[model samples]
Target: MAYDNTPSFDHLPIPLTSDLVKTEHGQVVFTAVNGAGGLETKVVDLVDGAPGAFAPRTPDVRTVIDRDSFGRELRRRGLDSDGTVWASRAKGRVTAVYNDLSTDLDDAYTRRDDRLMLQFVTDPDWSTFGNVADGQYHGQEEFGDLLDDAGHLIISHQAADLVELADSIRATSSGHFESRIQRSTGSQSVGWSESVEARAGAAGDLEVPKVVVFRVARFEDFPTVDLVCQVRLRVKGGQLLLGLFPRPYEHLLREQWQTVIGELGAEIGRDIYATA
Candidate 1:
């Protein structure tokens, strides 16, 4: 004879502890486990439960490669040819270093105490609303707005600041630039060097110092699947200045981005320079 059996609730998998709790103020707080194995609590009164809190973390050890080593790897990966990594920026004295996201995503993560920021830099003409009249400016405005929206979301979620250039500026040439330079103080600073250093050190094996810029295109049109372009810029005189151009689709690809970012390490390698 065949017998029928049913699953019991007592045998079902259940969490070890309560996932959420309501405070006297009517705010919902989530429970987490900290290093001490104690309950780490957080306020979850947000639509997305805090924005930047869940950004991917970089690994504690990363592959370390010099410019030459990086170039060889890029060639092996078919991302570059004939030692020409930054061919597009040939006139500019810069080289690119590529990091495979599949293997390198761990190097981008931040710890609980560490602070993260998303900075947006664009050319003055491209950043303004008036330039939207031009055909070339159509998608550019939406892209910038997307970046601004992303920044706002990040700030609201992570309680961080978004820095950008000042609006009013007098320039002699199109290349001349100015930045508003807003930063978080009182235990948080926006100086790029310190942040890079911390991120690089997160993985003891990662030696290359490069700024990873994540560029998203067609932001409004396809928010979910927006293309991401990662690039690194070189720092000169202990300072790195990026030019903002007004092109929506025109962006620095991953390979070129690495080359520009690789240049900054050369500056940091110099013994005479000092970081501000």
Candidate 2:
């Protein structure tokens, strides 16, 4: 059976190369029907300029996505007013609502069960940091404070490599570790074995962790999340700068970034394009 071959706004792995798109059959001329009108129109407006040309139909958010405010998100981004759109946070989720064309897709990119997490990720105070002496800052210290809620947060090595590195700092090395909920896992595959404890230790040493995986209890329960994070730090001018960068799961996020551009080209649904 044939289909519309519609592509999402941030669906493509790599954006269109001009009006041409690569497909399984072969490359074909590309075109977009987007929320901002079309590819050509969006580009023209971007270059030459066309402000407020496409005022959102429900700019005031009068049209609620649903009545259950305590459950699913009722808000949306006005620019994503396509027949359907997918939005997620930490890149692990993919959800879409097949609107009947009347309901505007106006929710923010990601809606969370924990509202504070949404604000913390999207809007953070980056200026409150002060210089910490050498020993003052420890393993993921600065970033750990972001989740001060007791019993609702836990972080651990996300990968085999990081696990091995963590093992290097301990008195003994275990081939496997458990998740936050006391669930045990199988042995991990890493370049360094349980012997890493002796190899990396030398006269009492400590090392800060770089890339790690963190999980938050949704609504103060469950621990299925596996969000990746990396410590962002730089030192210069006698000052130390530090920050945290959140990322989605490896397979989940990296793969979804690729959007399908086929014979029908793509239906942008809405045109404020961006990287997933």
Candidate 3:
């Protein structure tokens, strides 16, 4: 069925490529749409420029072929507006795109989701266990701590070998990795952990060593104390070994702690199976 091919922001002049898209000073701009169906813009700090533009602009178009076609192209290019895709044609090229969530998406997109309830160690100082000389055992301790705190695992042959592990995995790899703070209480008391994970597309059976570092911290409000955790992983040989360290914190309910542990266990299993 044919669909309407009208731009939502008909009132605002269609942004031109030459238009100065305002961004936060020293920040990269990512423009997207909002839930209200308005133009949204976000800015990210520039590190070294990657292989592509930080905020790619869609071609300006006076007309679109059809709604579906436009939407398809926007999604293909990783653009979205208010959960809707933006499509248009400009400069003789059919184009579709979405704005960056930071700029165009609502604050809700930037807000943290709810914390996952799991049983966590009450001691906030549990991160201390990660201290050891750089070695294989150290890598293991780090992995264990990460599994304990957050719900992720890292495998590596040596503690000092994590960068190499990351390099090896990134090379000839077909997936991606994401890092973020998992959960945190608004106050110093009561929160979840931070962690990182790698995802690979199905490809050749590649074996790389794994290594991880875990960091956890605890605060004393007694029952409502906050727990913070961080983990990093690396690949070892043909198999992925993990090093994890968990931070210590209090006030995490048993259910929450169990959930975290479960996630870590599942990730470990996946890591092993993937290597196999």
Candidate 4:
């Protein structure tokens, strides 16, 4: 039987492309989408953008198409209002596509339902322990001091890389927060194998902004390098989706994220966005 609403991924406007970076590894492309009010912009890294390579992988296109399709379907089923889908449900699709447009259509469902993401990456050199230092800074900090620096804290492994990273965060925040260790399961695969949750105050206050500090593991075999520490502030109950394209997610996060960035910069003694 043929269904009237099989969904179409057509009629979407193509974004004009601008080459941003080209290296032996790959190229990063920037694009702007013309909309009714203004233009929406985003950046995509083309892993296979070298000459004679196949069509570039454009997850942003799939992202836009799936959003339109999902919204249309929701409106047709009379469930277009807010909160019809929980953030937890929307964030379940945790796959990242690097350079495979062949899978884009297959992954369209996941892209359609994805929760908007905001991320902050301090320079790998932000701390000696970060990826920029050739991994020489591991286990350099006093382990016991980290655990005792704040209350309600525990150290899963004295040698865990996150400890040093967490210490940098605590020092940057002026010791106002404590750290609790948590691990990512088969789900929530934002790439943090081990993470430290930072809470406010020694006893840990629930009302303050929640921060998760973790290291995004690097694939040594991959052409790209990604040995960096990340700080993710929980959005929690607010609208997770920021509709502004081209604008940095850090800005979309507004004051809350910026406050943490400033604190980190002060602690590490470098402007986080100066190189960007």
Candidate 5:
């Protein structure tokens, strides 16, 4: 015979105690032990039973994160103390520090955040959309060799306001950018869920410090099996936080990151991020 492993419901004499009393307003309340072994008082209000006194109530912690409340909508899935989103797929920090605004177009350069972004946006040969349109890498035997070169391509431009920049990108790019929240879904077996809205669209009325995300599928080697490439722009505290995320490791390679930056820098018609 198989040994039975069923749990026994025998009550232990641990001195369990509870208090039940009726209030002056003809309502009943009971004080008992909560799940955490702490004393708790709760009203046993029900349609069948006696109704407890109606009163206003404050929300608890569990109700905050579990529901689609403001707290749940504004917290990052994974973030550091410095408010930077780290990506292991890229094998380096994707974010960088913001410096003084540049007005000089001739001498501007790319920052670390922008450099990391180029890896996903530019072609394998580190060419921009204009270069590709101009046939810079057309019919070239070196195309395969350049595609294998992994590099960062950072492209950024300043605008008087975030709405203006977003409008410009929407006007130029094929896809229209919209304000939305990135909610985490799926089980742990698939992948842990996370929220990108906390940092991206948390500005509410203040359009200056907002987050904007866009999709980029221009590259040939963009992994179709993995998550799509998403570029996140966080504008806050009078600085811009730019980075690429959710890239699978197989797509990363080495190449010259500056080539694409210089190309876009000329077309953006504004100054680019330069090191101090």
Candidate 6:
């Protein structure tokens, strides 16, 4: 079977020891593991009768692991990553996870994280973005060649506090532009999972610095992204509008998509990654 470690929206009971626990390295039998699992189990005396009580034993090496959590809502409140590998499971170097999920996903599998993001060779292709009625400064990149229904989901801030939005996707940090996945139905969709956003800021308010990479992916092989367009800022209904547009990569992205379908859902062999 495919090594499917991707997070799901299904409801599950409190996992017990011996139960298969999903990790990046495939399913492993669950153990007391850590405080999150054991604490709840030990205090409440969980049903599975998980082993014995805690004791001081040989010092075992432990690394950070991200436990999956589920949410119930239409438009999600934050970023969601879909990957098979968790580098932090083995590498004990990380202390905190305040960074973006894309970087973490990229870092887990390979060192060539830079290869995932695409560089825009041309200037802003704003030929399509022109004047609109009612003084609405609205425009959008041509997403015909790019994936449809999953392209250009608009993020409208309640106020004009997003004036610095474009500044967040500078060349130094572009992958994060649409770094956050907006919405996913958990079926029949590849990368470009419904208009990613760059709202991965450090503070709870999400002031700045959320996502930078341009993301695109294919069907098989390690999940990856290819290209991303620049962030376009405009105003509609007194709310600041933000979106990532597909400028030059439309044809290339489509070609990669077509190639993947042609090869029976094989890996996309192109250099499409999060745009940085």
Please list the Cα RMSD from the true structure of every candidate, rounded to 1 decimal place: 28.3, 23.3, 27.6, 26.9, 28.9, 27.1
Judge candidate 1 against the unseen true structure and give its global Cα lDDT, from 0 to 1. Answer: 0.30
TM for every model, in the order presented, reads 0.17, 0.24, 0.16, 0.14, 0.16, 0.19
Query: What stretches of model 4 exceed 4 Å from their correct place?
Result: 1-10, 48-276
Candidate 4 lDDT over residue span 1-276, tens digit each: 986988874557566656577643457788787655567787776665354573433323223122234344334433221212211112211111223223345533322332322122233322322222232221213322432332222222244544454454334332222233233531121111122466432432212112222222111111222222222223222211101011122232234334544553353333334211
Model 6 Cα lDDT, one tens digit per residue, 30-60: 4442344343342332323443443222223
- Please give, for residues 198-263, the per-residue lDDT of candidate 3 as tens digits: 643233332332223333332121123233333333434322333333344333534443343344
Sliding window of 10 residues with minimal summed lDDT for model 4: 238-247
Error of 6 at 104 (Å): 57
Compared with the true structure, the alpha-carbon lDDT of candidate 6 equals 0.29
Better of 4 and 6 by lDDT: 4
Q: Positional deviation of 206 in candidate 1, in angstroms?
A: 60
Candidate number that wins on lDDT, 3 or 6: 3
The positional error of residue 192 in candidate 6, measured at the CA in angstroms, is: 32
Score each candidate by Cα lDDT.
0.30, 0.32, 0.32, 0.32, 0.29, 0.29
Minimum summed lDDT over a 10-residue window in model 3 is located at 267-276
Best by TM-score: 2
| Residue 213, candidate 5: alpha-carbon lDDT | 21
Stretches > 4 Å off in candidate 1: 1-112, 116-120, 133-256, 269-276
**Which is the winner by lDDT between candidate 3 and candidate 5?**
3
Model 1 / residue 212 / CA error / Å: 32
